[model samples]
Target: MNRFNIVYYTDPLCCWSWAFESTLRQLREYLKDDCEIRYCMGGMLASWNTYQDTLLMVTRPAQMGPVWMQVRQVTGAKLNERIWHFDPPASSYPACIAVKCMGRQSKNAEEEYLYRLRKAVMLEEKNIAKPEVLLQLAEALDKEAPGLFDLPLFKQQLTDETTINAFKADLNERKERNISRFPSLWISTQEDERKSLLITGNRPFEALQTLIHQF
Candidate 1:
């Protein structure tokens, strides 16, 4: 049996995840052979009420116009700042369910849809909280999200309170550990079952290459 699992906990709406994209992506490509990695959703927003608090949420992207330029320059990704005003604050719940929908409906397809969802929220600045936006994004994948909306599996899986609770519990557990921020990976190998080392956040290929060599 696989004794240890690598928990890659992240929020789809997190800015740091956007910055760390290039690096974490490299890790996935390079380390797939040596270790088992699974993608898990960290629900960043549970309700719309929570969004009213953050300065980033209530204001238009024009409020922090520099963030748009900075993120693009750093990550080489594009974002549509107008999404903040045109749509609502990105809730990530709909996108989360969209990912769950993909996971339930198709196996490999989930990852692709998840990446798209992340790009929509992080780079494109789309309101992922809205089902309509999520449905539209899913449409690009040739997925009929509107149909899935009524499906018992999607309704149950996507709207499951237990799933959110579980995600919160996992987040709490990780927080208690106080390891580091999102986009951080922990590797546990059979040879070393004692303690795990924290990988630096959003680094180059050399960082992951070095960590893999540690095993």
Candidate 2:
């Protein structure tokens, strides 16, 4: 059997990605040691000032509530749309950069932090763009898993040029690959890099399993 690699392109603030979390967990359990998954941050929203969604006509924060409601209705994911009305995040770049900072510590840290970030924004109604909130989440994670991250190092890397550049590379990769949606996956067997598949949008576990098997 050939091992596989999946490069998941997602944004921390993306509701669709949050909805797909359960399926992602199931996929990991099914693949186990046979697959290696890497996360690539897609800067979904740099700032509201420059944001525009012609398809949804979402030019302001309040308009995002309906989008989240639609995602919840379709995917059955727990989400609080009130955040968009009350405390919407101005940008997703901070959380994305924070995940990259966590990656400097360990892959586990990066994955765990990303999960927490999604949960915070989608379910907990937390504004993840704030530095204080990001640090608080990191502290909570540290309490849960001892030595998972170096507090000082993680904090330092939050504003480090290298970490920012790493996230920029991910954005560049997404642009180069023409990936405009969250939860986009690029999967390929270790033996043949040229032969690969790209899956986009939220999908059911059975659908994903069948697709991976066919690939």
TM-score of 2: 0.97
Which stretches of candidate 2 lie above 4 Å from their native place? none
For residues 98-189, could you state the per-residue lDDT of candidate 1 as single tens digits? 66556656545666677777788766767777777776776666554444333445445665775556455655666675644556666676
lDDT values of the candidates?
0.61, 0.93
Worst 10 residues of 1 by lDDT: 53-62
Candidate 2 clashing pairs, residues 3+ apart or interchain: none
C-alpha lDDT of candidate 1 relative to the true structure:
0.61
Q: Which candidate leads the pack in lDDT? A: 2
Q: Residue-wise lDDT of candidate 2 within 1-215, one digit each (tens)?
A: 56899999999999999999989999999999999999999999999999998978899999999999999898888999999988999999999999999998899999999999999999899999999999999999999998988988898889989999999999999999999888998999988988799999898889888888886
Cα distance off (Å), candidate 1, residue 100: 4.6
Give the top-scoring candidate (TM-score): 2
